[model samples]
Target: MKKIFVLDTNVLLHDPQAIFAFEDNEVIIPAVVLEEIDSKKRLADELGRNARQISRLLDGLRDLGHLHEGIELEGGGVLKVELNHRSFLRVQEMFGEMSNDNRILAVALNYHLEEIEKEAAKQVVLVSKDVLVRVKADVFGLKAQDYLSDRTVEPSDLYSGYINIHVHPSIIDEFYTYRFLSIKSVPGASKLYPNEFVILKDEMGTSKSALLKVSSDGARLEPLFLSNEAVWGITARNAQQRMALELLLNDDIPLVTLSGKAGTGKTLLALAAGLSKVEDEHKYKKLLIARPVVPMGKDIGYLPGEKEEKLRPWMQPIYDNLEFLFDTKKSGDIDKILMGLGSIQVEALTYIRGRSIPGQFIIIDEAQNLSKHEVKTIVSRVGEGSKIILMGDPQQIDHPYLDTVSNGLTYIVERFKNESLSGHMMLEKGERSKLAQLAADLL
Candidate 1:
C-alpha cells in the first residue's frame, strides 16, 4: 500500500535524491527540512553539495505545480512541503520556542495527529539518520525508522573486514592432495566471493586451516593455497580479520573497503590488488590512488610549496604504499618510474569531480575522511570499464560529522553490494606486524 514518508534533513544530506528513492510513495519534506537545507547550502562540503542538489530539484519540481500545495510526483504519490505542521502550540508546550529539532518533530507530530483524526488515510512514516529524532518520534507515538538504505554492515559484525569458516579434515586432505576444493554442494558453506579466506575445520571441530581464493565459479569455486604469499604471511589470529582478508583479495569481488587500527593493512592490500591488476593482468590502464586531504585532526596551514606540496603530508601514505610496490630505496626513484611508465598516478581526490574515469583500477583510501557529498562526487566519476575501491577504518574516522556508521566507506559498501557491475570485500587482517594487530585489538 502507498504511504507518506516524512524525510528528515539528514537523509537528504546523506543522499540528495532521497526524496525520489522512495518511488510511488508520497515524500513529505517538512518546512524545517528546507530550512535546514538552506542553512547548509553555504557550508563548503558534502552537506553544501546536497543542499544545492535539493535546491535544483525543488526548482525543477516548481515548474509542475505549487510546491506549497504539493505536486503529483512521477510514477505515483506526491511531494509536498508540509506547511500546516508549523503550528507550534503543542510543540512549544513541551519543548518551548521553535528549535529546528522541535519544529521538525512538530511536523511529524502534526502528521500523527492528522492520522488519528482522519479515516482511511495511509500510514505516516518518519525517516531520519538521527537516533534522537527517532526516539522523539516514539515518544509522540509516530512510526519512525533510521534511514538505513546506506548502512553496509552491523557495527558488531563489521570485523576489521574479514570472516573465517571451517570444513572437514578430509576436505583439508583433499585440499592438500588435490590442492583445491569446491563448496558448491557442501552444506552450510558460505558463498565466498573470489579472494575471500576460509578457515576450514573438521566437522567435529578438531582441526582448522586457512584457504584463499583463486577464482569464483558459483559452486565450482577455486582455491589459492599459497599460504607462503606475503599477503597471507600474517595470520588472522582473530575471526574478524580472518573475515576481513576473505573480503579484500577476492578477484571476483572488484571493490573493497577496509577500516581498522592504523596498521591494519587497509592501504597495503589495496595497493597489492592494484599492483596485481596493473603489472600481472594488464587489466587496467593505470592504478589511480586518492584519499581526502582531511588531516588527522591537524590542518596543513603552514606547509610549504603549492597545492601539490601542501598535499604531500596527507598523501605520504600513498607514497609509502608505492614504495612498497616498487621495492624502491627512495620515493624519488618510484616517482621517476611512475613518470616513465605513466601507469600510476597519486594525487588529491579533489580533482576527481566533473571528470569521468575509464579503464582504471581506482583506490580511494581513507574514505571515512570524505563527507557524504565528497564521496558522491567521486563515485559519479566512475566511467566505463573502471573499478573503484574505497577502504578506511571507520573507528578512526577523521570527519567531524561522520562516525563509523555514517562514513562513506560503510555507505558505499551498503549501496553497491547487490549491483552486478560491483563486488566488494572488507579486508580485516593486520599484515603490518604483530604489535599492530595487538594495538588494533587492545587500543
Candidate 2:
C-alpha cells in the first residue's frame, strides 16, 4: 500500500533529497516545513546549505506545476505543499500556540483524519528524526516513525564484531605452549570468520585472560602481538576493540569502518594502527589521511587560502596523531615527521576523486558527513593492495540528509559486514577523558 509520508523539517534538513527516497508514495510537506526551511536558509552551515538546496528543489519543482496543487515527482509520487493541516483547536487542546513541532503533528493528524474520511486507502505515516515527535504522534493516535535513514544495527544489537569465549582451564596452558591454539579445540568455541576477534577466558574463574586472533582459517588462533614482541600500551577495552585491532592488523581486510561517539578513540586507534603498520611493519607504503573540508555551516568556498592552508583546520586531528606518534619535540615537528617519513602524506578529500591510491594506509575521518554516493566514489578509488579506514560517528553526523542509519559510514558497515575482505567495528568506550565520557553519556 502506498503510504502518505508526512515530511518533517529534520528529515529534509538531514537530507534535502529525502523527497525522492519514498518510492511510489506521495510525500506531504506541511506549510510549516517550508517556513522552517525558509528560516534556516539564511544560516551559514551544513543545515543552511541543505535548506538552500531544498529551496532550490522546491523552486525547480515549481517549474513543473504549483507545489500547492502538487508536483508530480519522478518516482510516481506527488509532492504537495499542504496548507490545510493546521488545527488551532487541536493545538490549544494539546500544547497550545502554533509551535513548529506541534504544528507538524497537527498536520499529520489532520492528514490522518482526511485519509480516513475520504477512505483514501493509503497509510498516513509521520516520519521525523526527532524522538519526541514520534512519541507525540503515538500519543495523538497517529502513525509516527523514526526516519531510520542511517542505522545499520538496532539500538542494541549493532555489531560489536567480536565474541568472548569462556574456555576450560586446560586451554590456558595450551595457548602458551603452542603459541597458536585452534578454535575447535576450545569447547563451545564457534568457528570465527577471517577478520573476527576472540577473547578467551578461563572457565575455572581465574582472572586468566587470553586475547587471540581467529586467523583467516577457523583453525589456528594466533596471538595478536607475536609479530612485534611488544605491546603498544593500548589494549582492547571491549569486544569491539578486539574487532578493530583485528582489522587494523590484518593486511587482507582492506576496508575498515569505525563509528562511535565523542572520545571513542576512533581517530586515535586508526592513526596508531596506520603508523604501526606503515612505519614498523612496512606492510604499506605510506600513511595518508584526509577529511572533508565541508564545515558544519560553511561552504568550502569561505576559505581564503591555498588548499593546504584551508585544509589545515580540518586536518588538525590527523596531524595531532602524527605528532603524538612521532613524539615531535616542538611545534612543526609533525610536518618534519611527514617530511622524514617521505611516504606519509595528508591531503583533502576533494583531491581524492579521480586518483587511484594503492599499497597505502588511508584514513578518512568524519566519514559520517559523507553521503552514500560520495563514499562509494572514495571506496572505488582504492586500488589493489590499499587499505582504507573510515571513522566517524553517525549520531553526530553534520550532513543534513545523513543520519545515524542513513549516512555512508553506516551504509558501508551494514553492507560490507559479510565480506571476508572487509571488516567493521563500532567503538563504544571513550578513552579521551572522564569528563568527555560523562558528557557523551549525559548529553
Candidate 3:
C-alpha cells in the first residue's frame, strides 16, 4: 500500500533530494520544518549548502503548482508543504512547549487522526534522523522510521578490503619461487578487485602462506612490493598493519582508505607513510593533514586564539602521532620540528574546499563525519601529482545526520572498490596498548 511520509527538518538537511526518493508515495513537509531549515541557510558549512539546495528545490516546485496544496513530483510522488497543520496548542497538551520537534509531531498526529476519520488505508509514518524525535513519536502512538534511501552499506556487512584464499601447497611455493602467480592459478580467485590484498594459504594445512595483492590488470597476484619496511622508524606490528603499509607506501595508487576502531593505528600508519614520502624520499612537496570540525554534542561556541591556537584542540591527535614519530621529549619540540621542515601544513576541513591541492600528500582524518557530497568535493579538488588518504573509525561518527552506512568514509570505500587506482584495508588489531585493545573489544 502507498504511504504518507512526514519528513523532519533533519531528513531534508541530510539529503536535499529526499523529496524524490519516496517513489509513488506522498511526501509531507510541515511548515515548522521549513522554518528550522531557513534558520540554518546562512552558515558556511555542509549543512548550509544542503539547506540552500533544499530552498532552490522547493522554489522550483512552486512554478508547477502551489506547495500549500499538493503537487505531483517528477518521480510519481506527491509533495506538499503543510501550512494549516501547525496546531501547536494540541501538541502542547500532549507533549510540553511548542518546540520545533513537537510542532513536527503535531503534523503527523493531525494527519493520522484525519486519516482515521476518513477510513483511509494509507499508512502515516514520520521519518527523521533524530533519535529523540522518533522516541517522542512513539509516545504519541505514531509510526516513525529512519530515512534509509541513501544508505550504501550496513555496518555489520562493511567490506574488509581483503580475504583469505586456500590454494594448493605448490601454489604458495610457486608464488615465493617465481614472486608472482597467475590469478587463474588459484582455485577461488574469481572476481577479485584490483589492488585488493589477499592471504594465500595451503589447503592441506601446511605451514606455508603468502601475502599477495591483485595486480592492476586483475590477471595476476604479485607479492607485496614492500615487506616489513620501516616508515619513519615505525614497522608493521601485524599482518593487517603490514597490508595497510603496503597500500600507503605505493605511489602508483593515488587513493587509499583505512578503517578501524580506536587504538588500531590507522592514523599513525597513514601519518608515518606520509612523512616518509614527504620528508625522507621527497616524493611529495608537503604533508598536509586535515579533519572535519564536528562536535560531540552541542558546540563550545567560538574559540579565542590565533589560527593555529584555535585549531590546537581539533588537531591535537595528529600532533600526538607526529610527536611519537619524531620522538619529541620537550613540550615545544614538535613545533621546532615542523618549523625546521617547512613542509607540513595542518588545517581544518572547512578551508579545504574551493582550492586545488597538488604536489602534496593529503591525509583526511576522522572522515566518517563527512557527507557523500562533501567527500566528492574534497576528492575532486585533488590535482595531479598528489595522493589522498582517508582514514576514520565508522563506529565513532560525530555527525548527527550520518551513521556508519551513509557517512563519507564508508561511501568512498564502497564506490572506489572496483577502481584500479585505489586500495583499501581494514586494520583489525589494536597496536596502541593492551588496555586500549581490551577497552575497545569489551566496552
Of 2 and 3, which scores higher on TM-score? 3
- What is the TM-score (0 to 1) of candidate 3? 0.95
Candidate number with greatest TM-score: 3
The 0-to-1 C-alpha lDDT of every candidate, in the order given, reads 0.70, 0.79, 0.90
lDDT of candidate 3 over 5-109, digit per residue (tens)? 999999999999999999999999999889989998987677788899999999999999999999999888999999968466767987778788998999998
- Global fold similarity of model 2 (TM-score): 0.73
Task: State TM-scores per candidate.
Answer: 0.72, 0.73, 0.95
Model 2, range 1-443, lDDT digits (tens) per residue?
78899989998887788898888889999998999999999885557777999999988899999988888899999899998765657756887666888888888888887788775567899999887889988887899887764456664655556667888877877898888887678776664655556778888899987777766555677787434322244555655665677677778778888888888878877887887888888889988888887643245656779877777888888888677666778998777767777987888787787899989999999998887767888999998899999989878866645566677887787777666777777788887889999999998
Q: Using lDDT as the measure, which candidate wins?
A: 3
Residue 243, model 1: Cα distance from true site in angstroms: 9.4
lDDT head-to-head 1 vs 2, winner:
2
| Sort order, lDDT high to low | 3, 2, 1
RMSD per candidate (Å) reads 5.3, 5.4, 2.2
Which parts of model 3 have CA positions greater than 4 angstroms off? 86-91, 117-120, 295-301
> lDDT score of model 1?
0.70
Point out the worst 10-residue segment of candidate 2 by lDDT.
Answer: 225-234
